[model samples]
Target chain A: MAKILASSKDAMAHVKSGMTLMVGGFGVCGLPENLVHALAETNVKDITLISNNGSVDNWGNGKLIANKQIVKLFASYIGENSELAEQFISGQIDVELVPQGTLAERIRAGGAGIPAFFTPTGFGTKVAEGKEARNINGKDCILEEALLADVSFVKAHKADKLGNLVFNKTAQNFNPLMATAGKITIVEVEEIVENGELDPDEIHLPSIYVNYIVKGEQYDRRIEKRTYSSATS
Target chain B: MTGVSKKERIAQRLAKELQDGYYVNLGIGIPTLVANYIPDGMDIVLQSENGLLGIGPYPLEKDMDPDLINAGKETISTLPGSVFFNSAESFAMIRGGHVDASFLGAMEVSENGDIANYMIPGKMVKGMGGAMDLVAGSENVIVAMMHTSRDGKSKVLKECSLPLTGLKCVKKIVSDMGVMEVTPNGLVLLETAEGFTIDDVVNATEAKITVSENCLVGTY
Candidate 1:
């Protein structure tokens, strides 16, 4: 019940240099913007970030990349961020590119207390290199270890005082999974209701996984890419 | 110089493969273009690995919602009855073999139907998205790509020189110049594009190809 933090500044104080952090988002969707910005204002450095592509250059976890707070990144794709790509090519930062599904399963497995799982996803591919492989059901499967983070930053559509979360639409992509996999989970919600106010069926994440919650401020909801077609409403 | 651009021609042929009620995942590039060519009245449910299913057409300028985007980070509209979940569940549907088909773009495809689309060593290609998972889980894997690189190197090869996305996972390939089915024997030429011939495909292809007796012209 005391999980609510006074502000993002108060919440970001828990982070330190060289910590492994899980940031939740797909593109800019469901990014905990205020929390990320607050972390940027601090002097935290040499952090390893685990997320889905982080964000584009100007928003989401991209801010952390820009601030040079991250030393290594594990993501499915880094196409959108020119800086990240440049840094990767220059070896300024370490990058581990995981297949999207494997990334999700690894984090999920971590929270489930499973050490490793065999998946057919990367068999016979570069992803299978140096990994243990076994024939499962006549398919070559590779072993992928579970991934857990020191802390997680997630965004939610709504949360109750007790920390049950509801996410908006597709924005929920990696938030709930990262929440469970983090040793310390800090969430930013658009709105907060009383504990019993949230419907049980609608709660995407339970409070047990969350250690702190902060109401996000001045949400920009920046679009990663903008396109236009002549067809109108 | 052509009736349709090579990219569009490839996408057009790929669209024809969509079966009604197929739960399909389309990779970026030409695969994403297939949405523009979906047959009218066909109830194809497009799935995005970023956690959207029942995806609709790209919205107009007026209807653009900043929050609504596809896996490619392009703005898109959700069709009626569209459902959004987290990446875990979205991939659960994929790795659980719930998706009927997946259309992906590839750099090269071997005669054995092995696809190498994810990386080009020394060149900083974007990381693999859901291509590996889709190939593993989807019932049918279709590849849409150019027949040749800009340098005129044939992409249909006897073996992939690059990293493989999946081993012998591609069932069919729709390229700028032809549609070929990957068979045990080799690439089976199913359809040739306009102004292109079986001989043309054979000459251009690095992989051995078998011309089907019933090969038809591509409907570009």
Candidate 2:
């Protein structure tokens, strides 16, 4: 069973400076907000982060970027975070832009104990540059190595005492995959239920992948773009 | 159509290519506008790479859910049959060729169907997102954009000056001036947008284009 923690401070205690971390989210959605906030308060520096996108200028992983905690960032998109862009432009940060699909697969591969995989997604482009290439079944493919992290911060809607997780709607973007890719997976949940309260089949991630659980106090759940129909307005 | 802008016209023209039961992915910018022009009664499912399928219209203000959004990160609603999955599974559907078509915006498109849209070197370096996978795996790829850059240089080029997102992938292009098909023989002009003459398109296009004999004047 995963150990239940009362606050993010306890969970973040295991994180050290210069560690490789995988953060689960697509922008601000599904992000482990409490853990991120706790990490921002820490004095840790030179961390390497792997996520789908840098959240916004003042929230999520962007806070870490603004705090100068991250040295390297691996993400599919960097359009949302101005701080990250400024740092990347000024040579203060290093960024490796992976294709979104490829990024997801690399994390999944890491959790599955696969060293590397060949994919056709980035072939014949800048992403394929400096990588091994081959013609397989008449399709041009490029090799991409798996990505693993020292720790992972994941967010879920609910978790059983046994650590089974349930995520909300489209918010489940990278949480489950990142859960297994890290040596120590720390999850922050909105609610904690009894061990048998959660249906076994409904669990999105099994307890075997989680190491610690922190009950989140707040979820801003900030929408990056709040587009709505005029009729409804 | 008279009051429509070039971007809207491009999206309007691209919407006509959709067939019933087609599962399509729309890139950000003008490609997202294609959803507004989808023909009524057509059964089309929109896929967002962030992990959603059967994406519906923008949510009503009261029904907005921060957890639910499109690939562009805009708040959106899901249709009746919409399903949500993880990013890995979402990309699996994309890379596995289950997606029928993908409409994307481009910075430059070569006569040979090579696309350069992700980076501008030291100027603008936004990441590629899922464009590489979409172009590589979708059954059909279509580009939607303006005919010329802001400075009047034609974006339809003999070779892309910017870094490529994909090579020999784009099958068609719908721009403000006209609709073009990328063929082994080079670009073929299939139609000219309203208010633009064939000579105007020829002059704006830097790529060598052959005008099809059946070329029609586009109504939209």
DockQ of each: 0.75, 0.84
Model 2, B107-140: lDDT tens digits are 9999999998899999898899999999988769
**Native contact share for candidate 2:** 0.84
Per-prediction count of colliding residue pairs?
0, 0
Q: After superposition, how far is residue A111 of candidate 2 from its true place, in Å?
A: 0.4
Maximum-TM-score candidate: 2
What ranges in model 1 sit over 4 Å off? A231-233, B1-3
lDDT of 2 by residue, A1-233 (tens): 69999899988788999999999999888888899999999998999999999889978999999999999999998987888999999999999999999999999999999999999998988899899999999989999999999999999999999899999998999999999999999999999999899988899899999999989988786888899887734
Question: B87-136, model 1: which lDDT tens digit per residue?
Answer: 88999999899998899999999999899998898885688888889998
- Cα lDDT tens digits, model 1, A1-233, are 33999899999888999999999988787778888889988999999999888578866778889888999999988887888888888888898889999999999999889999999998988889999999988877999999999999999989999899999877889999999999999999999998799989988888989999999977996777776677543
Give model 2 RMSD, 1 decimal.
1.1
- For the predicted complex of model 1, DockQ is 0.75
The i-RMS of every model, in angstroms, reads 1.4, 1.0
